[model samples]
Target: MSDITLPSTPNKLSRYEITGYILIAAGAIVLFWGIIMFDLVTLIATGANEEVGIVFGEFGEFIGGIVGSLWALAGVFLFFATLTYQKREFELQRIELHKTQKIFQQQNFSTLYISFLNKHNDIINSLTAYDINKSEWSGTNFFVFFQEKVLSSFTQKVRTKEESAKTPELLHSFFKDYFIYHFSFYQTSLNPYLKNLSVLIKLIQRYRAETQDAGEYYSFITKAGFTQSELFLIYHVARYQLLVEFHNIDHAFDVFEDLKDELKVDRIVQQELNDENYL
Candidate 1:
C-alpha cells in the first residue's frame, strides 16, 4: 500500500535561524571594518621613511585612519542588518500569535464537549435513582406539547453538527422527537433530589454549549425528571436576580454566576445520591 499522506501546514522560519542570521550579519560588519583598518596600517608603514621617529609617527597616523574607516563601514552594515532582521522578527511574531489563537479556540470547543458530557451523565444518574423508565416521546402528542411549551420559548445559538437539520422548526422537531422517542420505554418519574434551582442551572449550562431554544431546554428538564412548574420557577428566579443586579447591562452575568453557584449544589446532591445507592 502507498504511504498515507497528511495535510501540511505552512512552514515558518525557526527562532534559531533568525538568531543565527543576525549574528552572521554582525560578524560581517566587524570583518569589513577589520579589512579597512589593515589596509591603512600598511600604507602608513610604506609612506613614512625619513627619520625612524617620523616613520613611526606616520605609521601610527596611517593605522588611525584605517581604524576610523573600518568603524564607519561596520556602522553602516549594522544599521541595515537591524532593519532586515526586524522584518523577519515581525513575521515570526505574527505566526506565533496565530498559533496561540488556534490553540485557544480548540481548547474552547473541547471544554464545551466535556461540559455537555457531564450534563448527560447527570441526567442518566438521576433517571437511574428514580427508576423511571425512559419513554419514547416521538410521534406522540407529548412531542407536540414539548414543542409548544419548551421549544417555543428557548433561543438557539449554535450549529455544530452540519448534517443535522438546524432550522428553528426542524431543530424543535428533531430534539422534541429525539428525546421523547429515543428512550421511551423508561418509566417516567421525578428525581427526588433535584430542585428547580438545579434544573435551571443545568439548562443554562446546556445553553452555553448550544442554544437555549425553548424546546431543547424544556426537553432536557422534563426528561431529567423536572416538572414544568420547576422550569418556570427557575426561569423567574434567574430573571429576577438579573434585574436586581445587572440592572440594564446587555450581558447576563447574573445568569452565569447563578449557574456557577448552583453547580455546587448539584454536586452535593450527586454525592448524597451516590451514598444512598451504596448503602
Candidate 2:
C-alpha cells in the first residue's frame, strides 16, 4: 500500500486551544524566570560570608523554582490531555452521525419516528416559560389559553410515562379518542406544524406495525403505567400537537408523503428487532 499523506490546511482553532496556548506560554515564562532567579541566588549565596544569609536566600529560591516548574509542567500536561480528549470525543460523535445517516437511508420509518419523538420533547420543554409568565385568562379564549390547556395535559402524560408507565395499548386508545375529538373541532389547532405532526403520526403507526414482540411492547407500556396500545396513541397525539406548533401545515404534511421505500423489511427481522431494545 502507498503512504497516506494528509492535507496541509488544518481546521480552525477553537477557543479552548487559544486559551491552552496562553496558559502554557505563561507557565513557561514563569518557569524560565524562576530558573534565572535560582541561578542568581546560587551565585549570591556562594559569595555571602554569613552562613544564615546564604541558607535563607537559597531556601527561598528553591521553593520558588520548584513551584514554578510544577505549574509549567501541569499547564503543558493539561493542554495535551485536553486535545487528546477532544479528538476522541469528536471521532466518536462522527461515528454516531454516520450511523444515524445510514439508518435514515436504510430505515426511513425509524428515522422519521425518532425525529417525531425528539420534536415532541422539544415543544413540551418550550411551554414551561409560557405557563410561568401567564396569569388570569380573559373571558374570551385565546390561542395561548388553548395552548396552555393542551400543554398541561401533554405534560401530565409525559410525567406519567416517566414515573409509572403501562402497556402501550391503553395509552394508545386514550390518545386515539382524545385526538379524534379535539382534531375534529380544531382541525387548525395544529396550525403551524401540522404537516410534520401528520408525518410523525404515520411514522409512529408504521413503527407499531414493524414492532412484533408483544411482551416487550407490553413491558415498556407497563413501565409507563399504560397499556401497550394506549401509550402509542398518547405518544402520537402529543407529538402531533407539538409538530403543529413547530412547523407549517405544508411541511408537516409533506413528511407523511415522503414515501420512504427502504422501510419495507423482512417479517423475521422486524420481529427480531421488536424483541430487541426500543432503539
Candidate 3:
C-alpha cells in the first residue's frame, strides 16, 4: 500500500461561524438583560405614581420590546447562518474522507501481489532468455528505444507537410493498434511489470472519468500525498513497461508530463532522467 496518511479530523471552525456564534450569544444575553431591567424599572415606578408609572412603563416597554425583538431576530439569523456553514463544512469533510478511503483501497497490496504472482513464470523466462540483469535497464534506455522504434517508425509516413495533415488520424490509429497489440501480448506473456503499467493507466482513466476536469483530477492525485520518489518510480516503471509492450510512447509520455506538471514535480522527473546513464 502507498505510504499516504489519511486525513485527520479538523479542529478549525467553518469560515465566519465562530464570529457568528459569538455575536449571537452576546446579542441574546444583552437582550435578556435589557428586558429584565425594563420590567424592574416599571415595577418600581408603579409603586411611586400609578399614572406616571403607566406612561413611563408603556414607553419603556415599546422601546425595549423593539430592541429585544431586533436582537432576537439578529441572533436567529446568525444561528441559522452558522448552521448552514457547519453543514457545508461537514459535506466537504465527508468528500475528503471518501476520497482518501478510495485512494487507500486502490493502492492496496493485494492487487499488486496478485499481478506479480500471475507473471512470476513469465518474468523468470524473460530474464533467463535475455540473460539481462534488471538493474542494467533504465528508464532512459526504454525511452530511447521507444523514440527510435515506436515514434519514429509510426510517423515515418507523414514526412512531408501535406502528409502531416493526416498525422492526427495516423496517430489515433497507431495508439488504437498499440493498445490492442499490447493488451494481447501482456495477456499471453503475463508480464507483471506490464500488468502494473496497464493497471496504472486504467486507474488514471478511471480518475479522469470521475473528476471530468483535468485540474480537479490533478489536484486529487496530488492531495493523495505521494512522495517525489514514489511518483518517479510509478511514472518510470509505467513508461518503461509501456515501451516494452510497444504501446503509444508519445501518448504515454504526455500523460507522464501532465502528471509531473500537475504535481509541480517536473524537476524530479528531469533529475531522474539526468541521473540515468542510458540517456
Candidate 4:
C-alpha cells in the first residue's frame, strides 16, 4: 500500500492572538466588576446616616477603593500585554509577506530563464551544425582562413593595377552582390541569435543587480534543474557569441569563467576549453 499523507491545516488563531483575546476579555470583565463594586460602595456611603452605618460605609469605601485600584492596575497590564501581542502578529505577517514576494520573484525569473535558454539553444544548434562542417578548424585556423581567404583576397583584388580601368565597375558589382549575400546570410542566421544573447545578458544583469551576488545567482540557476552539460553549452556559446558581436573576447571569457566557477562546472568547462575544436 502506498503511504498517504494528508495536508496539515493552518491554525485559525496563533497562540499570541489567542492570548491577546483572553487578556482583553479578562480585562473588560475585571473592569466591569470593579465599576459595579465601587458603585455599590458609593450607594452605601451615601444612603446610610447612623454612626454604625457610617462606620461600615467608610470601611466598605476603603475596601472598594483598594479593590478598584487593583482591578485598574490589572486592566492596564492586560492592555499593554494585548498591545504587545498585536505588534508581534503584525511583525509575523510582514515576514510572511516578504517570503511570498520572494517566491513570486523567483517564479518570474524561472520563466524568463527558460525562454532565454530556448533561444540560446536555437543558436547553439545552428553553431553546432556549422561546426560539424568545419570539424577540423581550430581557433587559429579559423582566423587564418578569414584573413587569407576572405579579407586578403578581396583587398588584393581591389588594389590590383592591372584592373584599374574596370576597377570601378568591377568593385561596384562585386561589392553589391557580395554585401547583399553576406548581409542576407547574417540577417537570416545571426540576427536572432544575437538578439537572444542580448536579451539573456540583460536578464542576467538585472538578476545580478537585485541579488548583488554573482555566485549566488549562478548557483540558484543551476539548482533550478539545469544540468552541468547544458550550463557548459550556454557558457561556451554565449562567450563566443559575445566575442563575435562585441569584439570583447577577454570580458566574455572572464564572465564565463566566473559563471562556471559559481555553477561548480569548472571541470566540464575546462575540458571544453582544452578541446582543439573549441573556439
Candidate 3 accuracy as TM-score = 0.36
| Model 4 alpha-carbon drift over 4 Å, by segment | 1-52, 127-188, 211-214, 217-279
Residue pair clashes in candidate 4? none
| Candidate 3 lDDT score at position 248 | 52
Q: What is the lDDT of candidate 1?
A: 0.42
What's the distance in Å from true for residue 21, model 4? 16
Tens digit of lDDT per residue, candidate 3, span 1-279? Answer: 123344454578644555556655665676567557556556665555766567566656765676556556656766776777677677778778877877675566346534544453345235211112443323223323322333343345334335325544454455335434533433443355445545555555455555443443433443243333234434543444544543553353254443444222233223323435323
Better model by TM-score: candidate 3 vs candidate 4: 4
Top lDDT hit: 4
lDDT of each: 0.42, 0.45, 0.46, 0.49
The list of candidate 1 runs beyond 4 A from truth reads 1-52, 79-83, 90-94, 117-279
lDDT of 3 at 133: 44
User: By descending TM-score, how would the candidates be arranged?
Assistant: 4, 3, 1, 2
Instruction: Give, for candidate 1, the lowest lDDT window spanning 10 residues.
Output: 245-254
Where is the poorest 10-residue window by lDDT in model 3?
128-137
Each prediction's TM-score against the native? 0.29, 0.26, 0.36, 0.45
Q: Candidate 1's error at 214, in angstroms?
A: 25
